[model samples]
Target: MITISVCMIVKNEEKVLERCLKSLKPIADEFIIIDTGSSDKTKQIALKYTDKVYNYEWQNDFSHARNYSFSKASKDYIYTADADEVIDDTNIERFVKLKKAMLPEVEIVQMKYTNQLQYGTTYNYETEYRPKLFKRVREFMWINPIHETVNLEPVIYNSDIEIIHMPVMSHANRDFKQIQKVIQSNIRLSKKLFIMYAKELFIAGEDKDFLEAKQYFQNAIENETRGLDEIKAAQCVLTKCARLMKDHNLLLKNSLKNFADNKPSAEVCFELGEYFFEEQDYVEAAIWYYNAAFETECELNIHYAGDYPLKQLANIYQLLGNKELEEEYNRLFSKWELPKSPDA
Candidate 1:
């Protein structure tokens, strides 16, 4: 069986640290815990599992901490995990079997990350594949009989093992601060970071959070090189920010940009619903809410297309004294389930 080193970076994770370490103890050959300024018993709990626990100064960057922890690993493979993650007995058995059967050429192992929507994190899906295991060292090989060429792509294996994520609290507030720091540093956000920032805003950002992100997204809209999807995401953020700040002109400008594509995002539709609803235009609000629930796909926060607008439509109908329609929408709202990822 391939030896595995469990590497983790934590800060003040006293509550869940022991539970996480105990669950992983059976499968892990060694634990490399790098504490980043924990004021709690997190380090004490980590030391009980392994003597490899070390302190690293808190840097705002996660990659630096993660890299430091990985550097401490002295095994064939590295299994990176968080304090909020737990592997059940059944999956533990599966993990052991995977270690024994792992191919030498596989450089990365992906496992299912579940329980994402419990705290309404940035992710859209309840479960998705995330790379958890990595080979300590990669071996390059030449391929093809006639025209030999070095294979540069890492051989990835998707495993059935699922890691349960049970965070004690949502990290959205902390994440927003980190994102704002990056924006304030005058660093350009990559496309992935840009989308993630937008998703986080839609999922859990407050009015102040949106306000902080306004300038960056506005700049993104005027960049001219950003793709349609990025532009749409920027528009969605700006639209929400405008509504919150009560800037009607900004709201209309961004919302119109969304409508110019002929297919509006459910987020914008829901925002318009709320705007009209606030103005006591129940009929207009119902139209937009209907569009949010049925006429458009959501770019972020599936609730906009699911329970959110359905509940709104139900309330609107109740206010309009349409009992039959109100009952129908309420029933739909009650039955709404999170939509599966397209690939799922």
Candidate 2:
């Protein structure tokens, strides 16, 4: 079996640090924790695991702190996680197997990042498959201050392992702060940064920032021919911004072309249906809403493609006096148990 070094950077995480360390004690070949000026007993807890605990002064850059943590690993493979992250038994087995079978040429290993559950709930878990394990000798480095990421070499392998994140509490304040800091910085905004800023603003519920995000998104649409996913996401953000602004005419005007251009996404169709419903054109609203629900249901059956909008369809049907359809949608809504609010 390949030896694995577990590395982490922490501060004021006394509450969660112990749980995180305990989860991996049995699996890890080595454990290293770098405390970035913890005023709490975080370091004390870390010392129980290994002498690899070191002090790293806060430099206002996550990359700096993480790179320092990486320097201490001496195993064949390096694994890292936040104080709030955990690994389950199944993934532990997968990790062990992957380590045993992995070749030296593998620079990085991407594992599933299981985030939230139910797709839309506020307190629900969020999950995504991400690169978490690394080949130590490959010398993978960390990048970015906020929203830091591991810079991996081109040749990589994916492991069917996972990292589970379980926060002691919600992160709304920190989420907004990160974005606000980025926005306030006197730095040039790349297309990616623009998108990030926009999303943060949207999440922060700032209308002015959302409009700025829309402008950046428009610029992105004008400049790029590729990145269909980002473009589509931006278009959707713009659609929501329009809805929030209650500019029905503008929402209809800007989104109509895209709705017609792409095979109508459930979200897009629902927006159009909403616009028409507000206009008291129930027939058109019903048509668009029905199509939206049908497409979503089909996609859901084929793949776990849609959520919440399925419930919205039920709500719209309730408005349209369709008892049978409403009942059917209600059944699905209960089954999925998606968030009651879109913001959730």
Candidate 3:
């Protein structure tokens, strides 16, 4: 079996650190923790897990701290975890089995990162698989300070091992402060980073900063190489801009454009239908809404894409005072099994 070293860089995460460590300590051959100026009991908790805790000065660069943590891995393979992340017991078993069967040539392994589900009361956490494991000999390095990404050449091996991220607490002002740092540092924000930074600004409710982000997003889209995902991202930002600026016409235009290119995404069609419905253009709105109700395969959408159209059709029929049509639409809506939204 190949030995695996779990390395993590954390600071002031006293509430979450112990739980994360307790979940994986038994499985990991070595536990290396790098503390970046913690003013809490983070280091104390880490000491209980392993003797490999080291202090790293805060440089406002996550990658730098992470790379330092990576350097401390002495095992054949290196795994990374956040102070708030934990692998479930099932995944732990799989990881142990995979470690036993690992081949020397495997350079990297991608594990699923599951985020909290806020879509419904049931809250089914969804997992996104990403590269998190690496061969120590591969000399893998992390890039970027905030939103750091590992550079994986060729292809990274994919695995079903999943990790759960549970944030116990966070610095509420982190986004605005971080963006201010990036902007003030005179660092050139790349297309990718600029979009991410803009999102942070929007969520922080910094309108002025969001405007600055909008300009950056527009510039990024104009100068980008026009990849599939990039176009979708650009469209999303443009739609957000239209919504923020309250230009309903612009929103409709972007939505139509998105539908024309991408396979009528649920969001795009819904927005378009919403605009038309608000304008009381019943015919067009019904058509778009119906398209939205049938386009995507997302489980959360459940029968929403199917049921929404029927429900809206019922509403429209009622509004038109067509009793028979309304009853027919209602019957159709009632016949199918529909999935409820977070509120529903």
lDDT of each: 0.92, 0.66, 0.69
What is candidate 3's local distance difference test score? 0.69
| Per-residue lDDT value at 110 in model 3 | 85
Estimate the Cα RMSD of every predicted model relative to the unseen true structure: 1.4, 7.7, 8.0
Kindly list the per-residue Cα lDDT of model 1 for residues 229-265, writing each as its tens digit.
Answer: 8898999999988878878999999999999989899
Local error of candidate 3 at 25, Å?
A: 0.9
- In terms of TM-score, the best-performing candidate is 1
Q: Which stretches of candidate 3 lie over 4 Å from their true place?
A: 115-125, 139-156, 169-212, 224-228, 256-266, 278-283, 295-344
lDDT of 3 by residue, 1-344 (tens): 89889999988989999889988976799999999889989999999989999989888777788889988899998988888888778888998889889876688898877763322122223555667888888755787899999867634678878888787544425655665577669765655655455334323334454454565556555764655555555555566566567787867766676667546555456546666676788889777767766665322233336666678878977887889988988998898563333321
Model 1 clash pairs are: none
TM per model?
A: 0.96, 0.72, 0.69
Candidates sorted by TM-score, descending order? 1, 2, 3
lDDT over C-alpha atoms for residue 41 of model 1: 94
